[model samples]
Target: MSQRKRGPFVSVQLMSRWRNIVGLNVGMGEFLHKYPHVFELFVHPLRRNLCCKITQRMRDLIDEEEKIVKEYEPELLQKVKKLLMMSKNGTLHVHALRLIRRELGLPEDFRDSILRTHSKDFRLVDLEIVELVDRNESLAKAEVEKWREKEYVDKWLSEFETSYAFPINFPTGFKIEGGYREKLKSWQRLPYLKPYESKEVLRVCTCGGIERFEKRAVGIIHELLSLTVEKMLEVDRLAHFRKDFAIEINVCELLLKHPGIFYICTKGSTQTVFLREAYSKGCLALPNPIYVVRRKMLDLILLGHRNTRSLEDLEEIKEERNGSVFRTNVGGRRDGDWIVPILDSYDQNAFGSLGDINDSKQPFDGCESGRN
Candidate 1:
């Protein structure tokens, strides 16, 4: 709906053709009408075909979200800059960035809006690659280091233990076998290369063993999640950058191994990895502006049809504004009974072909064991 130029609406006929892509067994119009608060069904003034538009409330929420994202552009740019600096070659593919752009709170057109505008900080090496212009020493510090510093100072832990220790938050019902805590503690104390530091020696070194190597990879994933607005990302999306970031381990299995440091959610079709410490009771411990705006959208969705005004009310409001009474059956009509008009002004060519739109709703099921 936000992508449409004419309005926050799409022709029901146009949308119906791709209903299967969204995994809808029912008719597209039937499914849309189920959520009246989110989608407003209307007859286009000229085309006389069924069409649906996002409710005014949804439109407002989307506008508010875009405004917040625009305001946070500087912070978003810094995140991208930091990501590039953390990469093995100080370069990241544009496609990889796009895969995780929503998680990073980057604008849809970040390539031109952010990279082109901030040419001093980012350079387009080629059509597919973006390279960091200058690595900031201050930004080189990994996010996990702050927690380690706090643990060392506040808890009076030894440097060896705290330097590499990750703040672990095992799921509520997670089981710990005998001697597991001691082994976990020993593993935590084993020092590994910092994610931002060069990995040339660590890559070749075998004295510290595979445990150290795996921990470093975990740190890389942890730092990447920390950089995101929500501190979580789709595992598949993260796998796209495995080559770029040198995460040689099986991403899913690695996440499963460290259930305390990471929470893997298979609630939906896709697997999402969340930094366990960054969330509290299925919510962000520290919500940023972008996250807050998105939460508002979720809140709106949860409202369902509770406060939705009927289509008759909308027509009355429109009539009052236009000073004309149009005889249209805009309300109290049975399903598939009313003929709704699709706007002729909407350019059919605007969307070359309807792409797959995933509207899968997966509510927060809380922390579950990775083994399950």
Candidate 2:
């Protein structure tokens, strides 16, 4: 992720600047030709720079997905409400918030919605900050308490708990040292802290109470991951909020300490973390409409990648009765026409490995394409 935020859409030339993340080993010009369906090239009318944009089909899918999110607005509202309550004085700057809005399935005008629709819970202050109208400090801790109570009952079956402990399918050969067994035992015994609970005296943190900070940190991180479409986020993005959200300086260590709740994966060059409890068998156990839509979007890219259609063939493709695109069979390539259904292509086991973006295959190894 860029340290300085950029919009979801970027000029193809600008994207070329970061070859690593975009998976462009060869020049972008060649790579662009290979995935014309995923990326469409157009000249900026004013700047006259030839740029690439996500296809209209992608924007349509997103529109449908946002509708689903709006349907679940009550759930997402409580989510944002809890986050604002977590902050001091129950306020958060809108600028810092814009980063995770998409992942959280929140609308760009969320601040305004909070005032207009959920006026009882939140308010906008000075057009710059979102403030809580009614603070529910125990909100997060209550959730922790419920989960803790349930897990404690399961603790009697130590063997089952150990064997099935929020399964983390780390990439091959990452050994778990023998001490892991002992550590798991102790970690399970640690108490859950209330988000608003104050700490008196502790030997843990130099910042007054170490345990308190950890509890608060976990609460914030938990809230963030919970709101995301995939209960996972780039660790660097979370680190960006270390000071803003009072997260620990050594965030990796903090997350590692709670293996039952979080898992840090180095699947990509950049580290990402997943909320283990939110996943079961490599897929989201509780996928809402937003995840459903995102999975469809992923299918579109994966499908196009797995089975390429020549540009000449797609050029002849025509619109159908519905807005969905359907590619006609050409040159004995694919069988008949298939509508790109929004819910067509999700693997049940895809999320079993800590929310893998592409469960079917590893990310493209080489960036450049043979195109052009």
Candidate 3:
């Protein structure tokens, strides 16, 4: 990382020292060797280990990309504002934010740059809590109430307002069983409630609104995902709030049952549920400020000296990219573009093993309260 006089951009002597500083599995030397455009690796006179330095062009590119993120500061503020408004209070735990920091493309100094800069709209109240300054937008729009409004008008022609049904962006190529669509329609017709309202009230109207619980659950999921940069999250992250959110003990069954609104992906060695509506064509409909920075990094990774890649390959990656998971790589299906195949209770998260999968068809009991 240091300069050497009358030598390459980086001093060769420092290469051996860098290996100790690098905390990643990939050695710093190997990492530099992989990206020739970004760095020039060579052996030093005093040291046998290779030394490297950033190319001037790479430095310029990095600075230019940083400018883009700074330019998009307002857009990122909107994302943070929306997240805080949907939290349990007006505040959110900083740790929760850190978990998806990379995927969201949040800056290392997100608090200093974005949050503190806009003190009128956001505040750091309790050291760890980021609270919203004021509430402006409705909670229903937290997901996509407008889409619901259109659907309700088209389907039931209901005049009542404050009634927003979440729109389902079903993964392409998914089969709609004869009764499934009707059930979703029925579920959609159920009344929409605020975050604080009792689940018991939904029952007064439903008469056994097991379906009512499902719709409410979808809204809760929508609220949770709205806080995230990507409208998706690991099921375990929200496990503690299952009771407060009115979700079932084993949410997989509930999420699996409603294939349209929620998509349960069992990739990345952990199960994650995505709100299908937030994404358009497998990319985040909304972009975080760090998105451009990540894209630039993507260019470097896709085109490495060790493994050269074509423009077509990068374009393909761009086309199918969404959230943290690469749709094309993880799913690896050609039946339909961004097609999300509904895995029945047979999936690993849904059932314990293949033997249990056979019993999956035997109606899962309504063990969860209110689901009955």
Candidate 4:
């Protein structure tokens, strides 16, 4: 809806055209009506036909998210640069990046704004690929390396274990069968090549054993998720880079196998993989400006129509809609100053484990399990 240039509202007939694409099992009108807090339904002033638009509050949240993205362009640029450096050939397909652009906190015009403006740092090849011109050795460090260093120094873990260990954060209620802990500990102690290390070295080391090869694949995925703004990505989107990253194992199975390090939410039309360590009770362990803005949007969606408004509040919304600019308090804070509080509790049983690879599939509701 935000991408439409005609106006904020779209005709109900027009929106219905995308019902199949959006995977709506019910009528578009019905679905829109269900979320009255997020979508406002009204007759078009000129056309005199029913149309729908995101509520004023939702529009404000979207604008704020865009502003936050613009403010973090510099940091996002470095993140993209580092991602290209971590790639096997110092390049990433344009389409693959577009698939997760929002997760990476990139502006819509990043191609021209970031890549073209910084010609010294990036190059566009045949308009299909983004290649790094100069790889910065300093930026070559993977995020997991820092975690390993911290564990070695702060936690007093042995260098051998810390060097290859990943931070495990098993979801609450995750079942650990007998011998699983010992097996996990031994796997953690196994050495593997880092994601940012040379591919030639990784190729030579993989010949030693399948365990080392799989562990290296895990490190690659861990580094990839850490580079994202949300620390999550669609499972299918990750498959697009399997050949590029040399992940021979089925991506879904690999994630399912390591319940502690990653969580796959099998909710909605797509499967999403979340880095467990990056989240605490469903909220980001470390929130950034962009993430905070997005969280505000989520809070608004969750608010639904249950949020009661007095006459004064309705009048203020009307005045704002009529272009009478003024600040108003929402939930005891000024609209511009509002920050959604982190959720205190979540469903412990929302997360389901396969128990073992041989175990039967279990119901998983990632949305309820991962609050953010």
Candidate 5:
């Protein structure tokens, strides 16, 4: 026969034998009930002479019957059998076994044996163990659900954290550093403001501001005015020993980390006092153009102007107005302000120059300023 065919036959035989043993024990109990007094007569030794041959056969059959019953109910049968085996062969054991069977309504042969040997204490112990196991399983299930919920929250936080910090990848074997600060200062026409990097190695942004240092410095400076709050988050985790990158963060947890610059990039939003709080902690305040443009004309005045006009062309007009020699044309022509004369200089490294402020490497200039 094939292997698969032989497997089924083997299983059937095993199952049949198992059921037969179970049935044999049940049959023995029925037979003993038919003549309960016969087992009681064994209590009298004088009756032994009346049943010499029959007693030996009966004892052997009872042992086999108990074994069959034990196949299904081993724990219960072992208690009964132990009590019977240790008992005397005559009247005392017989009477004791008989009282247990009749009073407990157990099998005549099994009850007497069970009453003699069963442990009341051990049964109580097993019940307690079962209760403890049930409680432990319930607690473990609740804990697992709690951990899953916490894991979801952590994953959400990680996404925000990773996106805030700028991470850049560069081509292998390519090195570019050291000269960027000089390059930026020259392009911005800020000769005195040399790059004082706090760290030896600079982490460059993929924005390519460092790469296009010589080409379009002026456009770079203008683009810095329009950075979004989301974009600024890319540089929040940047590690800088010199000047930290300015970023506007929405998450409250980040505020506790001693942010270098707390920027409010929303347009037309009232955040002046909020910026001042951060400034008091040595953090720079960066407000977007919407807020900067609305402040009173006096608020737009800046002290540092190497030339007649600023990048906004609003600070250099001098005229005799109301008996005071004050600068006019501060914000725009709408205020009847004169156009400030643009300073002229060729050396890109000059402290303040029209050409250099318009340079390419210093694109991020004038976007963020500290509160007075």
Candidate 6:
């Protein structure tokens, strides 16, 4: 006769205690401990009887039991199969047999076909179908991300959307509404005063100093004429314009419409000084008439007293606007007394002869202050 392995030397009391600890029936633990050979003796017959030709009701019961085990003891199916190879009790053996039959009855061809058709990697077959699905979803997600990145870069460098936009709105009680923004844009596009490169270099002067004109200064004016150029240019450009032309000629045209100022004689050393500065700075000074008008207006706005209608008031406004002490009462008394003629009979004769002229020599006294 073949000899069997000895059972554990556990007493009944110890068996009961072990059963309580393992949450098994008290009698079941003791019986299992006392007759370890019973598994080998009865499990095979019990498995054959319970699983063979099972009825529909028995199949349903097994399916329900399998679902419960899957939920609460997911490892039970796998552990029981492994344990069956070593030793088994009728109950555990029956459970394992039913699981094997159910698994075998599954649509083996359909399961394999689905896996092969849908799986991103065949190596993942041992994992649950949900896990395979998740991995494939991740791959699809990666493909989508790649497309998005390509689109972003393609759109980022495209020039089609580079132009600026402004909307038009109609306010209440207002008709004939359109976008002033577009009008402003059109105005910006209008050509600004260019450097004497627009012609030949013209002489420029300031009362205090002088310089030669250059294209760069004209470029600064061009930049100031429009918003797009303004954004691209530097603050230092404004500084350079201020240093070169105390009264920006572009804005001088706008100030001319509003009056009440004085003009000082712009000939002699003053014209020479301005011409010299214009040459050095590479920008053209305004026509003498415009310059005189702007000069008076600036003085009145800046220095003349505050009352809206007094001579001193006009002088103060000019000063405030021009940052210069020069004032003029050139306009007839009918207009404000703010404008005064600065050019004498001699000055007027020289300007009339030199209309749109560029003579470096001091026209008034025919003296050359020389290149300053």
Provide the TM-score for each candidate, comma-separated. Answer: 0.81, 0.62, 0.59, 0.81, 0.13, 0.15
RMSD of 2: 9.9
**CA lDDT of each prediction against the hidden true structure:** 0.70, 0.56, 0.53, 0.70, 0.26, 0.26
Query: 120, model 5: CA deviation in Å?
Result: 85
Model 2, runs deviating above 4 Å: 1-28, 40-56, 115-119, 137-143, 152-183, 196-212, 267-269, 305-372
Clashing pairs in 4: none
Worst 10 residues of 2 by lDDT: 363-372
Query: Per-residue lDDT tens digits of candidate 5, residues 343-369?
Result: 111121211111112221211222321
lDDT for 169 in candidate 1 is 49
Identify the runs in model 3 with alpha carbons over 4 angstroms from their true place.
Answer: 1-40, 44-48, 52-65, 116-118, 137-140, 149-162, 169-178, 194-214, 223-254, 278-293, 305-372
lDDT of 3 at 325: 32
Model 2 residue 142 lDDT?
Answer: 36
Between candidates 3 and 4, the one scoring higher on lDDT is 4
Mark the regions of model 6 whose C-alpha exceeds 4 Å error after superposition. Answer: 1-272, 275-296, 299-372
Clashing residue pairs in candidate 1, if any?
43-341, 44-341, 49-340, 49-341
All candidates: CA RMSD in angstroms? Answer: 13.2, 9.9, 9.7, 7.5, 43.3, 43.7
Candidate 1 ranges beyond 4 A from true positions:
1-8, 204-207, 310-368
Q: After best superposition, candidate 1 residue 51: deviation in angstroms?
A: 1.3
The digit string of per-residue lDDT tens for model 2 on 1-372 reads: 431222255677887888888676798867776665567777666677777766666677878887887788887787777667556456777766676777777887776664457877877777667777876654644344455445547545443343222323222223456776566544333343434443332223425456545755776677668768778887777776665455646887787766445667664466677765565434455766676666556545644444455544444434343423334432222313433321122233432321112222211122211111
Over the full model, what C-alpha lDDT does candidate 5 score relative to the true structure? 0.26
What C-alpha lDDT, on a 0 to 100 scale, does residue 365 get in candidate 5?
A: 21
Regions more than 4 Å wrong, model 5: 1-250, 263-372
By lDDT: ranked, best first: 4, 1, 2, 3, 6, 5
lDDT of 3 by residue, 1-372 (tens): 333452445554555466657554575566676776567566665665566766554566677666866776666677666656544466776656666554344666887777778889888877667787887664325445654455456555454422645544343335555786556555555675544343455546445555655656666666667656556777777564464344565777777766555666665357777765455433445645344344444544445663334323333443323443332342222224432232211111222110111112211111121111
Weakest lDDT window of 10 consecutive positions for candidate 1: 348-357
